[model samples]
Every structure is written in structure tokens, then in C-alpha cells.
Target chain A: MAPSRPYQPLLLRLLHGLNSIFVIGAIITGFWTYDTYDGRWGRLPLPQFKEIESIHGTFGLYALLLLPIFALYAFRRGQRRLIQPDTLAKLTQVGKPIWWYTLHRITNTVMLLALTFAVFSGKMMSEKWLPQGEFDHTWYYLHLIAWAVMILCISVHLLMSARVGGVSLLLSILDLKFRPQDSPALWSGHIRNWLSQRFKGTPK
Target chain B: MKQNLALTIIEIIVFISIIAAWIIPLLPKLEPEPNTGSLILSAPGAVWLIPVAAKQNS
Candidate 1:
């Protein structure tokens, strides 16, 4: 038999991959929209228009719609990757992969928070708000701040992934390899058990 | 091999982003505010926006 390959759950991979696409789309379009309207801070020669703002807002809305599902999976099924008090202790360890793991978790958490801010503040803004030369809006400023946080966190997240798991791990996620045992047929059963366990107060 | 592939992916994303940021700005802006307000749609004072109106005034 071939050496047992590392097993990342199929559902986890699907959710993570989908969310990554959405987050990246949100970032680029979000920045493009910012550069379009708010060129006062620094103007990129990029063409500005109201229509591009609509595209950015639509992507932001899609992310908002998908976020709760990703959060549920992260907190319930993949809780170990989330930062807890124990995670902080791991971060204190020197010369250990655990510290890198902790950094990954921190970036994951920050990315989610940044997206939340992006969605909410972005919803509060109108396409015309910035075009009318209105720069004093509180929500617009908050959205800009959220975009900045996302850029920083995402850049670090990219570096940290290579620093830790390396290309094999990253490519593993991108790979479409699936086994008969990891089929979607098992998902409903798993979800039912998880929900029942939650109601019955059983430990996850 | 996977590690190198993963790093290459990141490097590609960063590279594309830099290229895009520079390239996108080169697209034209909205057609310079329609220098001549459409003749049929003009409001009474809209003609004042025409350069000829300014020259005649001067």
C-alpha cells in the first residue's frame, strides 16, 4: 500500500477553499473601489466609477452571507486551530512549530474579524457617498481601516503558511484528490450527530 | 516539492497584484465631464458651462 497521506477532512477543505476565494476577491475589489473613490489620500491612475463600487459591494455581501457557515465549522469542527488560552501558552514556546501554529491561528482570527468589519462598514456606505467628495463619513473611514487590517493580516498569513507547512501543505489543499471514505454522503450524518451532541451537552 | 510549489503560488499572487495595481490605473476616466452639455437636454443656464459662453462673457 502507498504511504498514508495526510488527511484533511473534505468538508473542511471545501469551506476553507471557498472562503479563501471570497476573501481574496473581497480584498482586491475592495482596494480597487477605495482607489477609485478615495484618491485624496493617494491617487492611483486607475479609472474611477460608481459601477465598480457596486461590484465591490456585491462581493462584500457574498462574504457576509458565507461567513457564519465558515465560523460554525471553525469553532465547532476545527476548534483546535482557533486561538484559546492554551494557544497563547504555545506561542511562548521557543524553537517549536507550535509557535508558528499559534501565529497561523492568530492570523486566521484576525482575518475573520477584519472581514466582519469590512462587511458591516461596507454596507453602511453608499456608492455616491464618496463620489460626492464626502470624505468625513464615519463608516467609510472604518471600512478603510478594515481593508488595511485585512491587507496586513493576509500578507502575514501567506508568509506564515510557507514558514510552517511549506508548499506541500498548501498544494495539498489545492489538490482535488478524494477517497471513497471521504464522500459527501457522510456529511448529513456527521452534521446530525454534531447537532444532536450539541443539544445533549456532549463534548465535541 | 510541495513547499516550493506553495511558495511559488504566494509569489505569483504578490507578483500579479503588483502588476495589476500598475496596469489598472492606465484605463481612461469617465469622458472628461461631457465638455458640451447635450444641446436638447440643456437647462436655461447650462449653456454657461460651454467654453464659448465663457469666452463671450470675457
Candidate 2:
């Protein structure tokens, strides 16, 4: 019999879904904006709409707003998906499953950094710069670099996940199944329990 | 032991890179144009106040 698919936390699925939508939206719009305004290296034949930048900015704004919450969850609750003290050590074990897992963790961590920098550099930029035909701003350059890194990191993240866990793992993240403990209705109680445990120095 | 040292190095590099990214923006006095008169404080902006604006406020 086939093994049962792993279930992800309901909150993780929700946040990950929303975050992916905004991030992908931002990426596509970002490319359109780049092609529209500052295609200094090579220009695409796509139609130029001055409004693409505004659309991209909106996507970026949503992403920026959601990032901290997602990051907190990732760093606090989903810590295993990120780099640990042994991650680098595991990298030396070439051709092993742990190496792939370590690489995946590293990729996840880097993706976070990539997203942070992309949002930051994009934020620092003036909306007027591109409209005015000016593209020499340092933040603009950094944003471009961040975009490239994000794309590469995201691609690697996907590949690494597929490598480590195969297709079932990828499908598992999208699965809506959750345990009673992971229910959204219970989230507030969980938070309260955590807080009480923290302040009162007692187990929940 | 070598692997552990390498891990430390990577951690240091990542930490330094984040710090440098934060600090480099300050060097240029980069501030988003205020919408009205008061600065439009955003979540990211609040995390790192514009160096020039902070200097003026202080």
C-alpha cells in the first residue's frame, strides 16, 4: 500500500498559500515593470504600460505586510525547515539524503533573506524614478539584484524540496487535512497557553 | 570540527551581510519622500528609520 501523505498545519498552509500568491504576483509584475521602464540590458517585446509599476508596488505592499507574520511563524514554529547548527556539517556528506535535506534547509533560509531584501530594496525606491526615466538609484539596482536572487533561490527551493521528499511531499503542503491541534479555532488557546507558560513558568 | 568552523563562518557571513544591508542604506541619507509633511511611517520604515530624519528629530 502507498504511504499516507504528510499533513501540514492549517495555519502553515494558509500563510504559505497567501505568501506564495503575493510573492509570485510581485515577481511577475516586477518583471513587467522592469520590462516597461528600465530594460537597460535587454528589452522584452511586451506592451509597455506605465501602470505596471503601481501594480507591482501593490503586490509588494501586500507581501511586505504579510512577511513579518510569516517570518515569525517560520523562525519560531517551523524552525526545522531553516538552517540549524548542523546544516553546514551535513553539507559535507555529499550524495546522502541528509545533504539534500540540509541544502533544502539552507535554501529555505536564503529564500527568507531574498524576500526580505527584495521587499526592502523595493520599498526604499521612489515611484517617480522610473517614470522620470532615471534608473541609476542604488536601491533600484539592489532591488534588481534581489529579484534575481529571489528567482534563483525560489527555483532552488522547489528543486530541493522535490529532491528530498518527492512529489507526495509537494502535494502534502497543499493538502487541507489537519490534526485537531492544528485547528484555527484552537490557535488562540494555543497562544494563551504559550503566554501563560512563558510568564508563569509552568507547563501548559 | 572543521565542518563546525565552516558553519560558524557561514553564520557570521550571513549576519554581517544583513547588517551591511541595513547600514549601507543609512550612508546615503536615503529617505522616502513624505506624503504630506509628516513621514509616512511604514512597518519596514519603523524597523529602520531614515538616518537623516532620525538625526533631525534628535
Best by TM-score: 2
TM-score of each: 0.71, 0.78
DockQ of each: 0.02, 0.10
Question: Model 1, range A162-190, lDDT digits (tens) per residue?
Answer: 77777766666777877778899988887
lDDT of 2 by residue, A1-204 (tens): 988776778888899989999999999999999999888889889899999999999999898778777876886678778778787678899999998899898898888778888887887788999999889889899999988998998899889989988998888889877887777899988889888987999956
> Which candidate gets the maximum lDDT versus the true structure?
2
Interface RMSD of 2: 5.2
Residue A202 accuracy (lDDT) in model 1? 84
Candidate 1 chain A: 10-residue stretch with minimal lDDT: A79-88
